[model samples]
Target chain A: MEAVLRCEGLVKRFDDRAAVDGVGFEIAAGETYGLLGPNGAGKTTTISMVCGLLKRDEGTVIVAGEPIDTSSVEERRAIGYVPQEIALYPDLTARENLRFFARLYGLSDRMDERVDEVLDVVGLTDRADDKAEEYSGGMQRRLNIGIGMLHEPDLLILDEPTVGVDPQSRNAILDSVAALGSLGMAVLYTTHYMEEAERLCDRIGIIDEGRIVAEGDRRELIGLIGEADTVTLQITGADGCAERVAAIEGVESAQLEGEELIIIAHNAGSLLSEILVVVRDAGATVKGVNVDEPDLEAVFLHLTGKALRD
Target chain B: MTTALLLARKDLVQRLRDRSFLILGIIAPFFVAYILSLVAGPVYDYGFSADYAISDETGSVGEGLAEGLVDSGFGAEVVGSEDAARALVDDGEASAAILIPAPSPVGDPPPIVVYGDLDDGTAVVVAESIAESIANQSDAVRVLITETGNPASVGAYLGQEPPVGWVQGDAGDKVLDGITYLSVGMAIFFLYFTVQASIINIVEERMNGTLQRLLMAPVGRGSILFGKTLSSSLTGLLSMVVLVVATTLVLGAAWGPVWGVALLSLAAVVNAMGLGALIGTYARNAEQASQFAGIVATVLAFIGGVFVPISTEPGLFDTLTRISPHRWLLDGFGANSGTGTVVDVLIPTLVVAGIGVLLGLLAFGRRSKLTGVV
Candidate 1:
């Protein structure tokens, strides 16, 4: 399948410092690619270059087989960008706002149809006549997303769409985003939220500092942890228990957190009894135990040496 | 072009919805114009006024001179003696004392000696005026006595049957009312604020991230900037038109020739918009831009003599005042009366618009560093 978006050696510099340093990625048709990282990790900057919002210092961004040109209005129409900020005229009605963006995109022939379609997709058709400022935060965010899709662009770029939203609104936005991928629109999603990336992305790229550190399917990326499972034990009087657990076979490392002792091993389920035995032998009482399977958060932590939330 | 128009329309609509912009741009101008017109005091006589004394002579020449001066809105009184007339001036009862000497014996007409307290500027002005009036009347007396051989009958002097030819020519009427000047000046001043509001909207959009979204849209950056400038210009134009019409309807302000005022207003709007764009380019945010625009507008208005009429007798201050667009606009409007044509308005209009375009281009260049200027 032809890729909907591709970037190679994207580099953007501010003065002497590189904001996006030689970063590159591609998104195929009908796929959701998530750039997962902590804040200031060049995710927004990289996407900005891809969407032609910022000038790249050294790079080529091809969207739907055309070089990304910030000066070319037609070339930019292939990709829709929903910025991090809720960018809308607060005094204008939802319909007016949509019409304005639609006009900007040169969608004159079927303007009303397109606006109504996007508003319905975002479930804002009922309140289309209300001023944007009168809408709740969630509604405004939905309208923001709706504007990006008005032109039916091949690739939609959403920059941190769910930041500062209520949980219900966040979930609604996530659901809408997840639904977009299934409808055959390539999505380039950028977020510092690990769960959002995990829940919606088909392929994820873990970026740090200013470059993508790793990119793959969830299982393949998580395998970077090498078959390791974390075992958490709620224990009391766990003196020397970490040393005891680390000495057990197949256990790689162990650490204690308050009353909980954590053990990383080759197979946490099989080593649970042994870990408990080791803890008890060290004169500590094991209240409970849990073995967690590898996930993207672990993959992020393993690769970057920092938690996804950090 | 369509994109630019759409963006411009969007800005105009949003500006219309902004309450603060409405108050500052429209309501405040009319309010201030009305209040300032009241503070400017009533429209007094455009001509001058003074008081003078004339001696009671045997002939009717002295009384005739005093009557002519009094009928022309001056204060004139006949005195029994020259000393009493001088006393009236010394005691501040009259501004000047004029003594008509006895008839000439050597065929040369008698001189009308005028006395005044030169220390008092009004007295000096009155004395000079009386001296001029009496000098003109003395010429008429000489002509009458020479032609008709009669010095007692001054009735012919007051009528067209005077010995000297009295051919009269029409004088130009007042250019405009004082209140109208105040209205136009205030309108132009507030129109600058309207332009500032429009340009500052761009900074507000940038701060709110809508500008970034616009950049990502399928429209050239030039289109965005052009649309913004056009919107600012339109805002200024609309505010001015509303002010003009409202003040005319409510305060009875006379706006000379419709086409002339329109053309001048267009030029003023263009000029204001350009300055606003330049200010917006330098300012980092909306608040800063607004503050800077306000200060600049006030300074321009003051120097342009928006609150007070500057003397127009070719001086350094009048030359300096010409640098401001407000002066040119008011000049254009004031010229609308008395056979004024489109060219009178067009000259200032084009000059202001040209200056605006230059500043707008510079502002576009500065703002274009991030993107391309429109």
Candidate 2:
């Protein structure tokens, strides 16, 4: 199936530095794609280019079937955008804010219905009558998302929506995004949080220093790191224990820092029992054992030699 | 256009909810206008009078001069001696003393001695004006006596029927009392604040990211700008109209024709909106925008005769009056009855509107350039 959103060779420069340099990605219909990076890693800049808020030095963003043109009302209408900041008018009630945006989006024919539906979708229907300024931060963020989704556009672009949100609210927002994908809405999500990408995105694009360093699904990305599993052992008096664990079968390498012995092994789950026996034989009292499966964080570390959050 | 209207409506609603707008834009102008009108007291006809003491030495000429001063709105008390007249003036009973000698014998005019305290400059000026009128009347009678081949006794005849008749009218029909002037002045002055608030709203949105969100919406940037400006202008126009009407109804302030007031109010709003847009476009942030807006509004208020009538000043100060829309608006409001025509009002009104349109276009162009939004 044709992709709902596609960007090719997007470049945006500020002064002499390229904030978003030759970036490109695509999101198919009903799929959730994420651009994961740290702060100042150009994720917001790239998202801004896609939303037509910033003029790209070079690129074309095709939304739905049409190419993105900031001046074209139709093209802009096809994409729902939720900025990182809560952009609603503080003095206006949530419903009023949604209605105003709905009207601006030319949904005047069913403004009330759309506003009500979006408010319900954001779980703010009960408190919709209160002014936005009276809302808690999480509720305000939810309202911001509701405004973006009001027009039911072909694609939704959320730029770090969960930033500065409480944990419960962040989970609620994540669940909403996952629900949106299940409902067949194409989503382009950008964030600095790695776990958000892992939990919500079907496909992840690791952006670093103005470029997409890696792009893949969870399995494919973790496969890039040679199928290694991390085994961490909390021990007591575990001096000279790393060598003992390294001699075990299926163990590739072992390192001990303080009382924690971490082992990188091939097929670590199958070799855990033998590895523990070796630790015990090495005169170490095992306090705790954790077998960490390959995940995006490991994949990111393998690809960039730095943590995903660095 | 629908988007523009929605945006305008949103701005209007926000402004309505803001209490500061209600106080500054609506209540304060009327309050200030009412206080100023009360301070202006009551209006009266064009006339001046000051008490003058007439001396005993002067005969008919002194009598005729005293009579002329009385006719010209001055109180005259004839005393037996100059000392008595001086005492009357010194005791604050009379304004001045007038001494008339006996009629000229050899066709030489008699010398008149007037005594009063020179410290009272206003009393002195009024006395001088009354004295000048009486002297002119006497000269006219002398000339008539020479020309008409009548006897030198023509002074008595002229005194009975003063040749120089006075027909004074109230200082034009347009009564510019304190209330009327202050009402319009405060309205126009606060109008700058209203328009500045609208521009600051734009700056705030830009700072807070709503501007970008709006740009990303289906609406065009022109529509957003147009909607925002229209709302601000309407807020100013409505606030001014409310203050004018309320003051006129409550305090009985005569602001001339309703249509004239409205047209000028609209023109003033346009001018303010344009200037506000320019300030908004030039400012880097909301704080800078509000600061620049306040400075511009205050400068215009001073130059436009808001605090004091700059037009009354001479030379460059009067010339600088035309630089601000406040001056034109005040001039437009000041026009009434026999003083000005509808055309007179429309010219200044149109000029203000023209300036607003020009500045608005410049602001729009500059906004597009600054944002690089095509």
Candidate 3:
């Protein structure tokens, strides 16, 4: 798969401080790349440079096989940027806003149809004729996303599209983004929501302090900390079952705390039957079992030593 | 350019929807003009008064000239000597002094010298105008005497009262009435706010996050700026045209020839846009820019003779008025008031437009700041 966006050594500085230092990333067609980081982690700055809205101090941004900068209008045509803030004319109707942006992208031909299609994609078709200011926050966000995709850009860059929106709208936006990716459009999404990245991004780059500290798929990133899933078994008569369960193939350790048996393993869900059988043979009457799996939050914490929300 | 036009079109639509153009551009100016007409009466009622001292050495011709001056609405007093006339002018008792030398023995006419106080520019202009009228009448008498070879008939011609041409001297003969002048002045004054408000929409966009989206579009930053400028110019122009038409039909205010008014209005709009853009470059947000533009527009209107005509007496106020685009715009309209062509207003139009271009260039030098993005 050919890369739709290839950024190399992208550096942006404000006065003496470097906001985005030597950042580089690539996203192939039909892939959703997420830049996950906390606030002030230079995610917006990096995306600004990528969108050609800001002049980079030092680096190169190539979109659709052409070098792009603040002056590269042709190359920018291949990009669709959805800023974190609702970037629509409040006085203009939703359909009017879409048409204005569509014209900016030189999509004048069949603009009405394209605008209608985007409005449907973002689920704002019914309120298309209403002023954007009159719409609810979710409807406005949907319209904002609709504008970015109206031109059918090859690479869509969404800068925290779900920020400040309601949960329902956030899900709707995420669904639209997921649908866009399925349409084979390359997407570069930036967000601090770990679940959103884990759910939608095919490849996630965990960014911290202006650098991608780790980058890979969900499992590969989780593997970096060498964390394993833990299974807890609550039993009424589980005495001395830890020693037997620890001898299991996939179980790393098993310890009995009063009536509860705690077992750590590489694949706790797969070893469930065997571990249960072992415990039963050891005269343990199982009452309940719980399995805890590691997620990106753990990975971010294990890597950055701070919670994702923090 | 096409993208710029599209952007300008969208902006125009937005402004029209808001009705800002109608209120600020047309209705406000017309009401101001109506109020002014009610308060100030007609333009002809406004009068210029000056006192003069005359040294009539050429007995009959000098005394006749002094009488003509009195008839023309000036306070003329015949003094003892030329030195006394000079002393009266020097002491500020007289605005000017007219000294008629003794008739020459040769065929050439004697030179009549008018001494005026330089500090009183209006008085000096009036005194010079009266003196020129007298000289022209004397020349006509000489021609009539030569044509009919009748000194008595020529004497009667000189004895009659000369036309009060000096009343229309400094400001020009075809002046706009109180209502019309105020209408044009208030219209152009409000145009600053209208055009500036439109130009600073970019700052509003930045605040609303639309500027970032515009920057991300396939258009260059220059196109965005140009589009904003085009929209502002069009808005300003539209406002001016509406006011001009409204005042003409509603208040019966004469704004001169259609082409001349059109040219001057276009130039005025461009100039206002340029000034707005320049001010916008230094502003961080829409509110700040509006406050600054309001201050500038008010100052320019006050100095440019918008609220009231500045003293024609040349001084610091006079020099300051010359620097204002408002003054030039009014001058353009005044110059082409009646029986004047577009060519009559070419200088003022060029001047107003040129200042705009210069300010626009200065703003362009700092265009990065105008975008509110670094």
- Candidate with the greatest TM-score versus the true structure: 3
Cα deviation at B336, candidate 1, in Å, is: 2.9
Candidate 3, residues B256-282: lDDT per residue as tens digits? Answer: 788888889888888888898899898
Mind giving the per-residue lDDT tens digits that candidate 1 earns over B210-302?
888788887777788788878887778888788888988988887877787788788888888788888888887789989999999899888
Candidate 2, B263-331: lDDT as tens digits = 888888888878888888888888888899889989988988787643232356556777888777776
Enumerate residue pairs that collide in model 2.
B58-B100
Give the per-residue lDDT of model 1 (tens digit) for A131-190: 999999999999989888788889999999998899999988998899898878999999
lDDT per residue (tens digit) for residues A73-152 in model 2? 76888889988888889999999998888878878899999898888888998999999999999999999988888888
* Shift of residue B72 alpha carbon in model 2, Å: 19
Q: Which candidate has the top score in lDDT?
A: 3
Question: Which docking class does model 3 fall in?
Answer: medium
Model 3 misplaced stretches (Cα beyond 4 Å): A233-249, A267-289, A305-310, B39-170, B338-344
Q: Evaluate model 3 with DockQ and give the value.
A: 0.64
Which window of 10 residues has the lowest lDDT sum in candidate 2 chain B? B165-174
> Candidate 2: which stretches are off by over 4 Å?
A225-227, A231-289, A293-310, B38-175, B311-314, B336-338, B369-374
Residue A6 accuracy (lDDT) in model 2:
92
